[model samples]
Target: MNQTRRKRRPDPSLSRLDSLSPEMLFPAKSPSLTSSRIRYIFLLLTFCFIIYIIFSYGTTFRREQISSIARSLSVFSTRRRHLLFSIAASHDSWLRRSSYVRLWYSPESTRAVVFLDRGGLESDLTLPPVIVSKDVSRFPYNFPGGLRSAIRVARVVKETVDLGDKDVRWFVFGDDDTVFFVDNLVTVLSKYDHRKWYYVGSNSEFYDQNVRYSFDMAFGGGGFAISASLAKVLAKVLDSCLMRYSHMYGSDSRIFSCVAELGVTLTHEPGFHQIDVRGNIFGLLCAHPLSPLVSLHHLDAVDPFFPKRNRTESVAHLIGAASFDSARILQQSVCYDSLNTVTVSVVWGYAVQVYEGNKLLPDLLTLQKTFSTWRRGSGVQSNYMFSTREYPRDPCGRPLVFFLDSVGSDGTEGTWSNYNLHRVGNCHRAEAVERLERVRVLSRKLKHDVEQMVAPRRQCCDISSPYNKSMVINIRQCMPDELIAMNT
Candidate 1:
């Protein structure tokens, strides 16, 4: 019995050892360690995901913050301006490198900065602008130290795409050296609505008193609200005229050329001063205000010294002091919305179509230009050049004789004309075209012989060959002694 019991006990112990699973025992009871490893991997994934979320949130928050800040501050400026945005580099360093960012960050123009970011390469970015002013104007050259004003304007355009996107309708270009104060400008804007038309340029001295239909326009100082198309035309004029009129590329004449090329309805604002400062500021909105004194050519900076940087501030203070203080100005108003950029474009063509019964030396050109300009409380195309005249008389009333469009009987039909129907007899389109061309050449000769008779007394008296610019095709201003047609 003892032997049997001892054998059974050993058998039981052997069986217990054999009953354990090979995988369970081989791994060595490391359940806790396995659990710890899985938990660690899960924790690492969670941590990484959380970090990603936070970083993403931070980036989004920063953009929102910038947009929010811009929207908050631009509610009350006198001029509604656009600020375009763009990242010019792959990293933030290039943005920091530009002088624009420095000037943008400057306290003086701090309000002007909608964004300063690192946009990579040649791409453009336009941000929504804060309509800080009630009246809308554009401030493109916000920074100093750049030969490319167009680039600066491009940047500004990028910055101000979204603000007042639907209502933001105009652009006024002023320099940093001008008397520009955000608060006062805003005050002025709020009081008057400039979105009524496509363009409104500054005033120039208007001295011609004797010419028929001759506008006694004030000297247009330029740099005012123009249609997007007019602005484009001005740029094109600059490009083309720069090549043609190489000697006359100064800002002043170039500006005049731009105005002429657009054939925009030109009028002026006596308030838009060219220079505002001191005694200049005293009478005008600022010192040397354009109206106070058209332009201060007399300031010979004490033996030809360069103008100080403070000139901008000087102009700003002087202009700000008086222009912003008008009693008729409106109070600032607030709105709860973001300023986002809106895309804008302007397209324009030659002001007249001779085929439409318009005449060479066509006043119809001027009439078309004048009428095309979007008027206050009127519906019109933006590309129509605007005039700044207070009177409702022909806004774009300028003589348009597109002699260049003619090749003189090239298309034949003898330049068909109702005037010569009896003399030349019925002709085909080609013969009529040719006839019209012959008539054009003869009329031009006749006009050359009687230049003094056709043109106004002033222009005719001073120049020996003033008719060089004139190309009379049909009847003068195409009038059967009609007052409306004859006046121009």
Candidate 2:
């Protein structure tokens, strides 16, 4: 009883968290500190909730910034590739391995011959890197003298093949963007009995000096195929004439010039179109010959990495698109950075458009991209502008929204017409995106092809392209009395 009396009297008025019992420590309501404690707890909880809200929003905002940064970095990587090559000053054994170079065809054996513009051969080849390190200025053909550029390329093709690379029966002025329908081409070509009358798409048309050369048989606009004998004949003609007129602007004109010099007639076939520009119907694949024709000169979407159809998807619902029965060929250029000559990496053209209820309505008329611009530095750069049909944009905001592109290059026109606004917004908001779901799925697929190109080097000498496995008969064997008019 004496010990119990001493422990009870310590602190009944004093409030301590540790001193409190099970019920008294945190009672639902108590006379001492109950009201004040409830108010303090409410304030503390409100502050914590505010902090959590701020942290959550801040985390979301940071994630968006990081995503935007990644996109920007990817875009910037393309621009910096030249810079990387510039800094890397080594022509090591790796580059010289020949395996590093794709299309491992023995230049001697392969039928493909490239004829690029050759104005800068001498100046360019003498540099540290025999090939261009950056955007070649007056490059491609850097051989001495202004030699129509194509000749230099032809010579390289000839020399490479001559050096025991591969056996070539036919010669094609193959373009970069053109993807061959090898199966159809070889099959159709095998069936042909006469080579005298060359076969091009029977429905092709050509225009020269305001005179339209519409053919019932075929039209040859871009690259065309020729027998080795025809190639020799053309080579001889170029040998006789190129030294005399090396400064001519048009390479295609040079082809006509060679024909004119040799007095050789050209036969046309739908298969030998510039590519996606024109073709015919009936006894072939797709009968619908589009506004853009096809041949050696191919018109693919913008980038192989991101193929977006530059023009209107469908001509339906347009006010006057039905009038576009016949195709019109216009030589357009997109000047990325120039004044005198437009830099056309991809083949394309500009079409004017008007939007009507989510439809990208296009005008049938062909418009050209003017290679001219307002000056920024010392040099007057080419203005990258396309002619518009009826562009209704803000007069002060963006001025005009136009689609512009070039020929034989991946014809990626710059216009928001093809863009599905809601779809793009969804892309921006999506947590994760699939490439196949985007507008440029084809482009992504094409870009992926670059990996295949740069992958394992094929042996040039043994390189028979399985990609174009056709009637790979010897040129001499194919040469009967009727084919290519060769008696031998």
Q: What are the TM-scores, per candidate, against the unseen true structure?
A: 0.27, 0.30
At residue 316, candidate 2 shows an lDDT of 14
Residue-level lDDT of model 2, residues 239-321, one tens digit each, is: 44545435444344444455555665555444454322222111111111222232323233212111243212211111111
Cα lDDT of model 1 by residue, 1-488, tens digit: 45554353456656686676544434535554465665676699899999888777667787999898875554433343431112121134333333222222224332332322223334323322222221112322222453333333333332343332433424444332222233323332333333232334344321221121123222222234444434444544444443443333123333444466556455443344432111211111111111211122111111111122243333332232223222111111111101111110000000111121223322211212121221233542323112222222431322111211222222422221111111222334322122333112211111111233224121110111112223132212223333322112
Query: Model 2 — TM-score against the truth?
Result: 0.30
TM-score of 1: 0.27
Q: Which stretches of candidate 2 lie over 4 Å from their true place?
A: 1-148, 154-169, 187-222, 268-488
Candidate No. with top TM-score: 2
- Score residue 2 of candidate 1 by CA lDDT: 55
